[model samples]
Target: MTTTSARRAPSGSVSGRARDFRLYWVAGGVNLLGSQASGLVLPLVALAVSGSPAAAGLVGGLGLTGRLVTAPVAGVLADRLPRKAMMVTALLVAAAAMTVVAGVLAAGAATFGVLAGAAFVQGVAQAGYESAGAGAIRRVLPADDQRALARLEARNHAMQIAGPMIGGSLYQLARWAPFLADVVSYVVAAACVAAIRTDLSPQRAERPSFLADLRTGLRFVWTHPFLRFVTFWAAGVNFVFGALIYHTILVTGRRGDLPVSIGLILAIASVGGLVGALAAPKVLQRVRPVVAIPVASWVTVGLVAALPVARQPWSYGLLFGLVFLLTPMVAIVFQARAITVTPDHLQGRVATVIGTTGEALRVLAPVLAGVLVARYAPGVAALIFALLLAVLAAYATANVRKLRATVPAVEED
Candidate 1:
């Protein structure tokens, strides 16, 4: 393994500068599709086996617990190990787990324990794969290539929209089909990653204790004001949106609206996300963070605030579309800024610090929304989440100026 600096990348499209990035992107896209499809289908598999909603939820939670526990540890490993090996190993482990599920299903011997175990193992492997891949991509691509990052955002949204549709269709055909599809996706992704020409090795010279390495990751994020603020902001945003989407679907279903109408509303919101992700590069490129960051924050605030008023299906779709439409644009701009400023050695740690916090907080979003919907009118719940977004919006407006002054080297592409 050899060491190279992320800062050494030449100025160009990431694909042009890092010839291996095309492979990286393909690998990422395949993995995203597999993960999304499996995530939705796994709960259904559990439901089929156990015939209990609680059992299904527990199975899903176990998977999330696996990821949450492994995520921080994986970040340290990503910085200490050869990233390519880590990535390939992670994919193989996950694929093997899915193989077990597929085999059991085919044998007509699928059980709760086996499927649950496989899901948890898959999640653990996924965490490691993501932690390593983030550092690897950052290492390969030019630090300033915001367009490439935006492309990743677009890929995620596009695949996410397609994954569940594909998964549902496949599951109707055969219970084991989605799991097998995931296995094939993993094999393909692993092959793509293995083909990358970049040197995907750790740059650090000294090894630290596990606890010490974990502390370093947290310390780096805590010391960086922009990163610290954005971490909390992201968590809040995730929480609000998660609740908003969940409740919209739930309440719509309860009202006996045609499934197609409800699906259309959600589908429109997803389309907005896809469009936002696609446009994020251009939006990020043209806008200066000083001006862009604050304006976008307020725009989200306004859109969320309007959700309570969108009662009809068409209106819901339009308003939710507008809300999500701006979300990826703002988020990608923030991601571009963070990725550019993070050092090569600390990339994995910094990413985990922020990502883990956001996921942890987001777990509570549905609980809060459930309670709110049961007790109050939908508009009141919307107002509460809107207030949360407003606080972050104000924080962003106040902090962007200082971050600009302090981190002078990072700028919009």
Candidate 2:
């Protein structure tokens, strides 16, 4: 295996490599559809079954909790397990969880506890899939193909517009329809993994001691200034973003017969994200990650903060467009940074840590956001969160010295 610096690719090298990336993109797309479907369906289900917006909030919060709780363990397993197998299992488990939720809804026994439990399991499944899938990208393409990776990220953003609209439309017909459809998409995603051409083999076939493996991954993160800074900034931004996810959905969904309204906002936001995601590689080629990331974060921070004060379509629309463009860019740049810094053998663990830490903040943020919204207006919380994000963005940019010089340096063991 090569070293990270050994794989440093010229920016112009990504052309003519579309075929390899397309296969991986297809699988990602399948999962993306399922994710988008579930995103809308889960909240709707909780709202319908529990008859309270708080129940939906709890369910969503628990999912992030599951992700945060499972990430460390999943990180270790990602290094030891076969990537495809891990992803397939994650998809299957998620499918089963959704299936159970669907059945409970069908049976009219979908209590808050049941929804929370299902969400927790689904979150764990998502944790595993994310850790494995991020690592698996190396198996699918060479270093120079990162632009393709950016495109996949873009495609996912695009689906945010398409998937939720479809899911929400379907939800209007049968509340359970979205969940059932989500299950089938998972099945397809699993099959796609099984069909990938890469050899199915774990990198650490002997399975190093779990504690030892975890320590190594953590040590890399701690010792590396770049990872440290990025993780901190990402955690902060993710915390706020997580809150928005819950707040926006809750505010829109519970307001009235506004599923379409929610979908429309999401679709418009997706358009902005789609543009950002698709253009990320090109943007990064011209601008450094340090500059790009802080700009994006600040954009999100400002927009989300104004979410509460903004009266109607005008302010909300502008906020949505601003955050939409910036958020996806944040995600893309983060992936690019991770792909650069992580050693290939530790990709799974690195991914796990990244997902976990971000989600840990996310988990707490939503619960707090909900509580605050319940007490004060959602606007107040949004303002506070936005202000915090502004501080975080400033800190990130000020500390750019720690990460700006850090280029990608990954390799398979």
Q: Please list the C-alpha lDDT of all candidates, in the order they appear.
A: 0.80, 0.73
Residues 19-61 of candidate 1: C-alpha lDDT, one tens digit per residue: 6777888999998898788788899889989999999998998
lDDT of 1: 0.80
Q: For this target, which candidate reaches the highest lDDT against the unseen true structure?
A: 1
Per-residue lDDT for 80 in model 2? 81
Tell me the lDDT of model 1 at 190.
97
TM-score of each: 0.93, 0.81
User: What's the C-alpha lDDT at position 13 in model 1?
Assistant: 55
**Segments of candidate 2 deviating more than 4 angstroms:** 1-20, 46-57, 103-117, 142-146, 200-206, 244-264, 288-310, 367-386, 401-413
Per-residue lDDT for 172-282 in model 2, tens only?
A: 887778888888888888887777766434354344578978887787776677777777777877777667766777766656636666655666777777887777778
